[model samples]
Target: MAQCRFSSSLLLRLRSARRFSSLPNPTTTQNDAELVSNILLHHHNPFHAMESSLQLHGITLSPDLLHHTLLRLKHNSKIALALFHYAKSLPSPPPLTSHAFHLLIDIVAKVRQYDVAWQLILEMDRHNLTPTAATFLILIRRLIASGLTRQAVRAFDDIETFVLTRPTAQDFCSLLDTLCKYGYVKVAAEVFNKRKHDYVADVKMYTVLVYGWCKIGRFDMAERFLRDMIERGIEPNVVTYNVFLDGICRKASLHPQDRFERTIRNALKVFDEMSSRGIEPDVTSFSILLHVYSRAHKPQLSLDKLKEMRERGICPTVATYTSVVKCLCSCGRLEEAEDLLGEMVRNGVSPSAATYNCFFKEYRGRKDSESALKLYRKMKEDRLFAPSVHTYNILVGMFLQLNRVEIVREIWDDMKESGAGPDLDSYTMLIHGLCEKQKWREACQFFVEMIEKGLLPQKVTFETLYRGLIQSDMLRTWRRLKKKLDEESVTFGSEFQNYHLKPYRR
Candidate 1:
């Protein structure tokens, strides 16, 4: 979906949603800019007020104005929809265009208002407006963005049923890339096989497939695709090998002790092989190598790669710096990591929250609570990036492990208020902590909330909570949790002590 970016839009320059005592009095002295000012001010107004404001202008809406206004107020879906409808309700309705519809769809769909979006599509159909590939493209992107991979796949079927029998190569690939990116590689392949005959196969298409398989850590399948592409006379490019290397690093991370040497050799062999074939490894290539070494906690190798990158005259990006910094932190080389961070700032590479997170994690590991909290506050105050949910989980778990129950409560509430989260891990850790503290009521409350949010508890969940409940004679709360587990089809194994999130895992 296209970003509205209303803050920078020229229309928002009408004036920051400052409510003047009265609407700008339209007169001969007033101009078109002021008129837009009055209309655009509705972003901060309710539907009725915005509709009233639009009527006060006493002019028919123009398609161009509608398009621009929607773009400007896209962040506020209700007001945009109100203005869109107000334009249609005029005594002499102005002509509407697909641009207006698409803009509204883009705005509403972002908030996961799929029903409203589909309704707009129906309205477009009634207006005799034919949908374009761009229309479906926006839908596919949004669907995938919301983790709706199946719906995104069905939207591809929509392209054939509603838009065209045979979508262009670009359209097909757009959907293909969307599906593959969000861990929907199998669905992507199925879509490809069903539609592959309609278009000529290309290297980019196979590259996406390779990336998809690699993303899921199926190295064998990824290599098979690489071989298949070559057999089909579609030579792999540097980008292809870069993505493959990234996959290698991710796969290696899961079994570092078992595959450390083999993975490093395999990764470098591919890197050297690319060079030998005259495919110049780009900065991304170096960053991938740095990241792989970082994942392996091979700090020296990471530095060597960093030096090699500089020797090749490839300027390191933020990602490159982050990879090496991570390696330094993970290996307990805090002094060297701090020096590198200073170097990163001196070299004008803006440190991302990820850069700071490395230090935050190291501080936590050392139980340096003061430094950890300071780093966390600095990232928030500077607005580098929102602290990720993983960071919040770490913080919560850290305080809990230290037996700082009051601080743990504060952090838990703060995460919910800040919208970072109380994800599954957060809940699990907090529950474990609360139960250990014998705060059974709070533990049960959090456990219920976790279930309400559709998160399944792990094996440790039942073993701890259930055993405690029965022995402690808290059958009331126990009944509630047991009912939830039953409703979710979670089972206590025949051993009556083991459990898992999924039945198969149990």
Candidate 2:
């Protein structure tokens, strides 16, 4: 009887333990669903609940899960493995919805995965999810980046026909940007022409198109676009003013004497219009205009713009001071240029290679070899090795001008030691200097050395050598050069041949 009682007690204890084990632990699953829902809705922190849930569920989250998680998290990766897996795992994968497809397209486009983006779009269409204007815009941007402008337009036409909804202003702006980037400014203008009735082109679109025209040297077209923008009630922005100013600066820098006056007038007109529109000029706008005026020898106007910049609370950049210095130098105002350089240093604007080079060039032009050498030494002290061929050539010219043959040789050797070999200009300067000193034999020997070093002497070299020989009345040398010219079949223009033969005839 006692054994039966003990057995019954044991059975009752076993049942109690089993029941306790089977009961859900409140803390384990405690409000987990609520936590997940709250995370999905309220908390944007990607680190919340989802990863923990996956761990708790003992499920290894694949790339697809991570990708969808990231998309939900809004982080962009170059290759979205999660998205790829998500697309692969869907049973009867729904057509790529426009929104999701566009997001993927943009991500891929930014990463330059054109092929993958195109494939995704094709798969989306296969799933019958029609693309939208945004879809086409993303493709257009990618195509332009890939240098496929023609294909971009064809895609745009397809989107227009099938997407039903009219393209937005943003869409037109993107198309314009693509066309402008690819040197198809005319095609970009055509896009604006067709869409003019639908959506008025904004300042950004017009600016891009104008800049594109400027890039292709179509300044007239760029001006017309600027006028069109104003006529269409689109006020130009700082970017517009900056681009216009830059275009003027480029033209003036290239052809200062011939086109300077007209370009400066047009630039000032834009600046005045900018002021009338209550748009304050930024540092870039001020700098470009200052450069244009300075190059045109209009220092007073450049100074006035500088004052205007200061009044507007826009501090001049290093570029601004450099432009001013360059302008002053070009107009034979060296003292003023030096003062401006000193002022720049006081203003905490560090001079660049260009600034020092300008100073050196001016000094060299005045035969002030001492000052040029001082500046060159200062440039070296600043740890700025001259990278420009022009800078090196200027120093060489200065040394040659001073009859400092040893220093010229030193500079040439230094250039080669620094891994910067003599270019055609450097060779020309050296050869000319040698011949001018009545060292024809040395010049010919140097010419031979240059040829041995694989440097081709320019036509100018032959002319200089010929002139030197004739000035010395060395008929034998002239006959040798003529024979060489005939043997080489170097076609000399009538003027050059006449110039060479005149001294020989005399």
Best by lDDT: 1
Clashing pairs in 1: none
Scored by CA lDDT, what does every candidate get? 0.76, 0.69
Question: What is candidate 1's lDDT per residue for 1-506, written digit by digit as tens?
Answer: 12235423433444444332234333411343345534456334553645544543444345555566567677778777877788777786657788888888888899999999888877887778988778878877889989998888787678777775567898888888988888888888888878777877787888898899998888888888888878888888988998888888765753646677787788888889898878988999888778777887889988888988889888899899999999999999999998998888898888876887788788888998877777667766877666777878888877777887877777777689889788888898899888887788888989888877867777787568766676677879877887776665543324333453332211
Per-model TM-score, in order, reads 0.63, 0.55
Score residue 465 of candidate 1 by CA lDDT: 78
Q: Which portions of model 1 show Cα errors greater than 4 Å?
A: 1-96, 99-125, 138-166, 182-200, 217-221, 227-235, 253-258, 373-386, 405-435, 438-506
Top of the candidates by TM-score? 1
Candidate 2 local distance difference test against the native? 0.69
TM-score of 2: 0.55
